[model samples]
Target: MAYKYSIGHLTYTFNDLKTLLARATPFRSGDALAGVAATTYQEHVAAQIALADVHLDVFLREALVPYEQDEVTRLIIDSHDAAAFKPIGHFTVGQFRDWLLSDACDTAVLKSLANGITPEMAAAVSKLMRNQELIAAAKKCEVLTSFRNTIGLSGRLSTRLQPNHPTDDPAGISASIIDGILYGSGDAVIGINPAGDSPANTRRLLEMIDNFRRQFAIPTQSCVLCHVTTTLDLIEKHAPVDLTFQSIAGTQSANASFGISLSLLEEAYQATLSLNRGTIGNNVMYFETGQGSALSANAHYGIDQQTCETRAYAVARKFNPLLVNSVVGFIGPEYLYNGKQIIRAALEDHFCAKLLGLPMGMDVCYTNHAEADQDDMDTLITLLGVSGCTFIMGVPGADDVMLNYQSTSFHDALYLRRTLGLRPAPEFEAWLVQQGIMDRQGNQLPDAGTYTRLLGGIGQ
Candidate 1:
């Protein structure tokens, strides 16, 4: 019998799937309950549901029972027919894992379950899945999104410039930026964090980046990641604001620590959007987030740090930022204690944000006090690249003088491109070729005296 029906535009039926599963040997493992092999669609559905519940119970009791928190438990669970447990958020990370593993859940159910949980809960549950599984989910979630109109992401890999200087000195910072561009990095954006947070210092830095771009005829944008109010002030004074930068937190109270209210964020977004300053188009915002910011501000509300971090994305989405990255390891040893934690958090953060339809990148980096090294970063960068990461931070020698940390360097970007056969953003790649930094084939021009020529007359 043909078991197909149309509900609105979608044309698939539960009975058809049940019948198919009944006949499919792949679904009839010895582990499946007796008589579940499809005498009827209703019986098959019941067996599958029961088996899924068993998986949830075992997983919750074993894997996630210990780390269970009350706040998480209080969060909603997106189940049809009201999960036996009220407020699915109360379900442990293990339970989320169980639901994800059940394979019985349709796309709508998956999204509903994801909606009821916090970003951190999503992140923690992600830690239970294998890398390939997470990557597959990310691939299918390729949303038709655009930011900067320069850096193409979602199905593509990209990189960025963190041309930071210790004293916020424009000349010294310019040198680092030139080096980055000459090496064919910074397609995402030439975003810098001012060592000094004052509005005056921030303006000078912004102007300097803008000047370099104009002088070299570089087709890209710049950002001075000072406080939002300070950037807003710069915008009022008519400073060069290509992308407004802010450090957003998950909770309102945590955001208050940064002096960022939702209203203030809206003000900044509206202000920057009106400027039309971005090189590609005027979708101008850059935000950086980390797992520990809420706790650092003493505003975690007893939620796990990762969930708190993910909630920050909701704030970012409001502005439609050209770039939004989780500086995953920058917060140090307290929240994410080591390399293992950092890697897992990095993957989880990227996965969750992308799932939420944000152009997510990862600051695959670590502080000196954190128990991580170059090897761990290499692993993360590769894994994230494979998972279709939008971008990663490209610094000098893998170190940020201003931020006082290690990160992926310009050469690292090249290595990813070469190893994975990836390319920089189209416009930026053309600029690199025109500058002779990279050949037409996207290969770096022979390093013979290229650096000397690129840096010539800079100090003078």
Candidate 2:
């Protein structure tokens, strides 16, 4: 394209990620640093190609073929749980989808390396390798720094994202699709997604979070699930006084259970193995938040699955989760309707933080309403204000994303990146044009000045 954002600063968009990676260092053969995984190379590739709904071949042609396996092998390892280093029993569908969802090497290349790899598997594997140099290029959290002129950094940052779909490529494999995407240079993120069925997961994940050392852009998964006052107090105690927990959840999967009350769930969570607070090298996390899933007690939020889960997540982060998700329905400005109970539940977590992330942008209803677009955005702003959801996103598929960050979509399985944007769309062309995203010509970005002025100090 147009390369609009590249002319100056604020060029943080999905396209940039692809371009940067394309120009990034290439991987070398047999690089052990290419992220430790539970599955073998062959098994990993087979699963990547067989994932459901993924356009694997198309992704390979577009993003991978230009690079070599050695270049590709240097992938981001989302979690460093010992389980990741363990072996997989078989390439089942679940394993395949999970592996594919990761931003790692292609399944095709993985299969090619195996002795008895099949033709079908080879076709699926494609060419696989890590820009092994990329791994070395990354300056760990200790060294990652942020540039004042440009947003990309080498250390930690407040950046966040909410992706709309899974990448159809292996790059998606190494990166935790559904978790946080640590963008700025030396940085990492922390959050939970209710997937840890083990007691020690919190410990294991935190360790990995601390281990990702490199320079330049960094985005990775870091989480902790906690809800009850006691659990919160414990974390606080460990913090002010200093403490840490080493997770053994991956090793304690069988003990995880679905419960009915908050106390029971809390007990179950507390029961998980952990290092005493103050222990060093504890990075990856799966904190305790009263589970929001049906089997657990915290699921009363009003919206559908997306908001309900995200709402609880909001509380786990002490109420103002920097990033979150929501589900609202709209056609345009004059016609916006939301689920009230959901808003209440999410807002209830306001004490969570100074800023929170709302990976919102799901329309439960969409029709040809004239004022639908504006109504949707305005209402969304109002809802977010009340809900205290901070990090915003400008989703591409969003029928209504006035700007990128107040914010949100997703299916990549975890939270990742904060898309700072204010672009135009045409699904509701007439309505949006009236709102200023478009001009009389009905084409091209309105203008750099107009786009910036639109958010008007709401959130820069």
Candidate 3:
């Protein structure tokens, strides 16, 4: 017999972690102040470097411990994972400042590589050419993505959550997401993994998005920011949801049926934000440029920039909601070919194209990781919150949670917040855990009573 059909979709993400840590130039006392007088710039640069060092020391330590065990570590892990691992990457103000002063990059090698020589340096050039080829080959080799900003997450993006495992019931999975948000688990975001099922399972998607706020039991006011079903139900079933829900059409499903390209996307977006006084609902679209990037980059079916730019303007006029970016490799081979281009078009040109122009407020997306002991965790904590994106949503591998009939990802959730700058207040944190929306160590799954009480807390 054919499969009994129920869930919306199954999102398949190819783990491509070979990007390697963004090499930083280690701090050279004189490097930052080289242009300025040593006397004048010394103290300023020194102070900044010192502060970063302190943070690094603390950050490194925190990266090693688990959330419940460490106070500060939870914040870092939570920032990157509270919700999802956004592909956009987290770059904090402090991180940026440090990125400048850290001198983490190896300048000598960079300088040697930049300056070309001949004859006498012919041997060097040959070796360099071989090295370049090696680098290219390394990038081409698909690897596990480490969590953003983690010990070595930059190029090696390993996810804190387990990516390989059994899936959960659609609504049930969504319920866990809402639990994270309402009780304030990670980043107050909802992740809907229709994989390719939502459009087919329209009703499920509709109910999930409509009941998004209710699942968390957070007051409507507190329910301002969230992510949910990509079903057009915001326009079709219920009133268009506020900035809370970030709707993304499934990869395989967003095609001829719904015209998954940017143009159709923006058209639907504008329609949702029209605000039809009695006839229409509020116009709020969570703006994310990269969501479609991989689609366009994929040689097989990615949308063109021209079309993407048009959709960007249309949504800007109507104010688009969230943008759940795409990973570069999943769609095709070219690094910038699939997902990267789509993101640039939506976020870069789309913003510059129209008469009114699209606004920033973006969302980055990525996948799981493995190695990245400490540095990567530290990095993700600083990078996930940058760019125009506000909330990050990603898959919570079954491995991230306790083994049970139902699957979840406490690690994924925790990693998300830490990668960014989000830190949940301890009181609320304790309250959420006691509720059991978060998995506790047990061989069994969450009971009906636990689910019921958890959902109850969301609305109350």
Q: Tell me the TM-score of each prediction against the true structure.
A: 0.74, 0.26, 0.38
lDDT of 2 by residue, 1-460 (tens): 1111221342322132122221211221111122211123333343232332233223222322122421111111111122322332244323433453355534333323222221112222221222121121111101111111111122112222322222212122123321222111111222322233243443433333333311111222333332333334444334211111111110011112221232333443343224332122222222222112311222221112221232233222221122233223321212122333223222322211111211222222233432234344444334442222322332323332221222233211112222212111112223335445444343334355533443232121
lDDT (C-alpha) at residue 196 in model 1: 87
Worst 10 residues of 2 by lDDT: 246-255
The best-first sequence of candidates by TM-score reads 1, 3, 2
Candidate 1 local lDDT, 212-311, one digit each (tens): 6766677777788889899899999999888888888877778888887878888999998889765456667788898778778877654446556776
The local distance difference test score of model 3 is 0.30
For model 2 the local lDDT of residue 415 reads 25
For candidate 2, the TM-score is: 0.26
RMSD of each: 12.4, 24.5, 20.8
Best by lDDT: 1
By lDDT: ranked, best first: 1, 3, 2
Residue 62 alpha-carbon offset, candidate 3, angstroms: 50
Model 1 Cα shift for residue 9 (angstroms): 49
